[model samples]
Target: MNRKTLVLPAVVGLLAPVLAACGGSDSGSGGDDGAIVVGTTDRFTATKDAPAPFDPAYSYDVGTWNVLRQTVQTLMIQPKGDGDPVPEAAQSCGFTDSGNERYACKLRDGLKFSNGDPVTAEDVKFSIDRARSIKADSGVFALLSTIDTVETQGDNEVIFHLKTADATFPFKLSTPVAGIVNPADYDKGKLREGFAIDGSGPYTLKTETDGDAVTKAVFTKNPEYKGVLDVKNEKVDMVSFEDADAMGAALDKGDIDVMTRTMTPEQIKKLSDAAGGNKESLVELAGLEIRYLAFNTSAPTVKTKAVRQAMAQVINRSELVSAVYGTQAEPLYSLVPASVTGHSNSFFNTYGDPDPAKAKALLKEADVSTPVKLTLNYTTDHYGAATKQEFEQLQKQLNASGLFDVTIKGTPWETFVPAERKGQYEVYGMGWFPDFPDADNFLAPFLDKDNFLKSPYKNGDIIDDLIPQSRRVADRLTAAKSLTKIQDIVAQDVPVIPLWQGKQYVASSDDITGTAYVLNSSASLQLWELSRGVSG
Candidate 1:
């Protein structure tokens, strides 16, 4: 998802240097997971699990964005592990006004959709303008809040007028939300007829096979494409599974060349334990994703800061990581990932260790009765299957403190998301998948009134003061000091408790080289970098 700064090496095979970086051979060659047939249940190329809308403007989740990256061309793009927004579809682009509110770009000549429609400035204008207008569930509008108008001048030039002066505007253009779409093929307020896309990307849909509500889409080199990525293979086959089991079975049978995300902790353990299996078929990418418990401040028991702080104080992250997640994830002490700028151990800094006796004293100080009764809510579908055991472990830990009697409840993600948004659960599990690699994304989304968290957290210093101040600075490194303070404040306030950061893994059959090198930081596979190993 050159769409955001992320990694699993969760696209591990994509970062070939990681092995050398991790003390492997210099060429960073994966032995041979490089089979021609690739299989993944990862949502990065989907219309269902993630932001399922296949149209460029409607796709927001990383899975959908990754698929679009192969199918559509944007003005700019972010490469693996790098957040810088660089030229793609545009010959060149730059801000034209002193306010940093006006941007302009020149289209690369001879670009066309797979359908053969000429790509032009009007298509770029329409694509962006429609994304702002449609406002789909994928949450594309959050990234483009500064845009006010898009002006097209002839066939090659396009200019954007923005409502605010944002230096990150160029990075926004690199996303698929701004991928140019042909006006003749798409209508306003409606998605394209089917998920099969028509674009000027390196690959075009060649054939699609559907059965039992799951579809496998095959992409062949787009004859009309004139872009950067060199295609290593003539075709790529991607399939979406009913669930993890279906995908795991395919991998065991060598039905696919590679498998992406959604491997269960148990499944990951099995693969890693196999002899020479990890070295040949897998690469583990330590990730930036955080899994935590959000304490609904409106809930009667946790309404006060003292109660929330007690909950945070009593829980041990190390225990959760080991007992439940195994090697798949590590203990997290900060809201921001260490890979990103402004990552501080604010939570760790605030609370030194899991102090149950101290927790009971704090609850007493807050006038909370002994044996506090509380319910912990979670979703079985969104989080991995290991989540149930994790939450159960959490219940044991909280109960062992002698200050809490914790109850666990489970719901599916589709129902859980809306319910959590409505503040239906007193405390619920939430995972942070950054919209972009910026520390701003990790903080800003939690601060806004209409935030992704959907909570009633209104910290004026964070939401109104620090975040705005942080965004005004163009350089992320310079903004770190300000953003780090934001995390410190959130940690002290305790609207949510930071638990653990995930370690992402990409399992590929050993025949593949470059699987680790091909994924962008977002763990979205650059499927083109993969090639089958030549047999002796």
Candidate 2:
């Protein structure tokens, strides 16, 4: 738990080639004192029922973690490219037992948070124990569930005892869930309520808020920090936009140095067309983010495998990607995206291009009548404005086939999340941004018995055998065979239908340096990597 340098995986290598050219510059304005300005539509909002989004115990989304990665130091940090986590707060960390259950890390000699409090083993223990004990619904309790107990060894070292062998435990420590906070600034049982942040990261953050919404977060380089990251910029101003159009416009008008997160397909196309003027302005990186549909297996409508498989056969991914997303995304054929270590196009292999004939044949074979009824649900506000168009396109495709009756419904994200979680929807939409960069992260969350999807998707081979087997291997690539088998099983069962894979695009004013480094394969932005300068 104590901040220490731990090893990470080689997931970065998967995207490094595409990101190699992101560091160059062309022409654009720079912030004062070499500071950087960033625009994003990703809002970190806190609700009355949920804890403060800034608190590590409560913050579960990618947007909040993007900011937290800059201000709050984890025990280990994932470096920019192809390697394990280097020592930031901790000097060294690794599994101490052959079973991979006992992990330990020794803190650096003189590590301190922004508050000047010494980073110690006890603080690490308190942080982990408090997070596990709170178990807030909004918190990442699932990620920390593997830890059986935390014990401190002297003032500089901390040890973790796990319930089972988990080779992915080290990667978990590199996430914001394992972010080490100052014990004094946080309570043992409650979430941190205010905007004030104290941590051992490379920068210190101050926020500008309107009511509960954060408008901007100003990050100043922490002079009293010690970490593996090289602080490239003296200051960073992260500005939040209500929508992607405004954010895109800000980048065009030079109001912001960089634009990221959610941009409309139209805006992306515009930028992509304009990229010929200055190619470096549009920085594209290999992304692991994906969008898919989750079917409630227990629901009366989509419960049968024949119905789900037929729908899968009828849903044309190529058309969906072209009409809805344009060139913004690619058709994803598997639960595990192509960027991950072990990815197979099991769905594509089973059912080729959209075949209404095959779909009708499937239904006939199963003794089901034509024009089967199905309600496709999607969120109107959460993912992006394009979501509405995406589902409408799906409805068109399904209805055009004349093989089924499909009704497309749209709901606000606030209501959609709870409704889907409670299994109120027969078939609903979901998007995944990985908690870590690995094949296990892509599979375990949905295939497990107690999955986040809340769908009745339980496979004994996947949940009990394949998943556990995959996690036991330290080398992630070696576990690809097992991961492929798990994907094959899910494809056959048709619990979830893979839709499209997303690519990370950050449009920066040509003057911005390190735009490529701003986001990793996991799609988490490291603000410290952004600096004001002309690219080569």
Candidate 3:
């Protein structure tokens, strides 16, 4: 796709308030320049710090890998603003009728990795095999478990032979986990020892400073990139901050052009009000994210179906959304948020409002004693400001039911991720930004047995039969129906209770143009489509 540039005039008007909420301000003028500045809380501080060996094969968490994956091209990529898979590194792909067990991908000719290495069928084979071998924290490999073997068919073609039938196999190929990389950059058999990222995405990491530890990630246009990227700016500057409040303060001072995961509704409103008074300065995007509560079924107390169900019933979703998030978030009941397809109100239909008496009675019937005390943990910097308050409300609601005792704890994302993966906490609050824009993306990660959660939930019928059975059908509606059934089962079992769907909120300087927002499951910013504007 041809690149598009948006230019907003610096004219003063009512647009300022919206711009202010979006992190734009009308201050002593700096004219439209070719650069875009982005502010975010916390940089991915993985042990390996170099950008050359930044292969997705060893990536588990989304923060660092996502930046790398976007820079490096994958075999396939999710379409912009949608969940459907489209071409990326590969030209085209489809399944062979070998009973839906064999899949083939055709790569675009002359495609090259950032290092000038030719992207080949052999590279595809190496990437897939390496991902499975390392089996990093990424859950994408689980989708490949069905693959029997990967063989290069020709210079531009590769085939995946599956041990069982699977139609969703192509979708798996589109995920960031399956991103293509150069085998020459690192040992294909072993994980990279240091922080080096090398791939064929839209950008490259140029310099990383260790003192204040600022990661200066820059995206250079890929000359060999033949995919559908409409990048406008020549380069994107991603600035990492240690604190959300500090990031918000920076945005207010015009030190940052874009701020992620920092602004509160009150703060956004203040910016919007400022923009309204002065036309050339601010922009605001409301409700652009999602957050939820996850139950560690491996925990003894949470393992009991009745206890899980009681906890779900006792949650006051509306109150939680209103009190903690204000108007920035809406009440959510399904694993699939309202913005996506196949979203349902199954949870609301089953359990309406908080009823402590009913919750207590359910626990009693399950032969569980009252005052069920459990510790709840959450990441300190990952979600947002409202996360702690949201969990606190949950503790209060549950405790008020007199059915359980609740304690709350918080940690940073880097520590919380591994701890939760090891099933360290009894219960924890977690948030999922979609890997892809499909309902399947939300359900598969949490419910899939090999996921990072490593949930002990074993529904042979769902995993072994229903899910795989649904994949064979190419129709999304039919696949959605099967997924809906799975959601119902999860709801009844309460492995993870539905919390609230967060709104994507953004503030941009009025001088920046061509910055149309495209919502996705990943919640990633499409830097390619952003550009400096002529006026407000």
lDDT of each: 0.72, 0.79, 0.67
Candidates 1 and 2: which is better by lDDT? Answer: 2
Candidate 1 or 3, higher lDDT?
1
Off by over 4 Å in 3: 1-34, 48-54, 98-100, 211-214, 277-289, 518-521
Give the candidate order by descending TM-score.
Answer: 2, 3, 1
Stronger candidate by TM-score (1 vs 2): 2
TM for candidate 3 is 0.88
In model 2, how large is the Cα lDDT of residue 358?
94
lDDT of 1 by residue, 223-291 (tens): 898866677876777776656788777776667656676678877777766663232356666466778
Residue-by-residue lDDT tens digits, candidate 2, 64-173: 88888888888887777634666667889999999899999999989988978888999888888888888766537677777999999899999999988888888788
Question: What would the TM-scores of all predictions be?
Answer: 0.85, 0.91, 0.88
Best by lDDT: 2
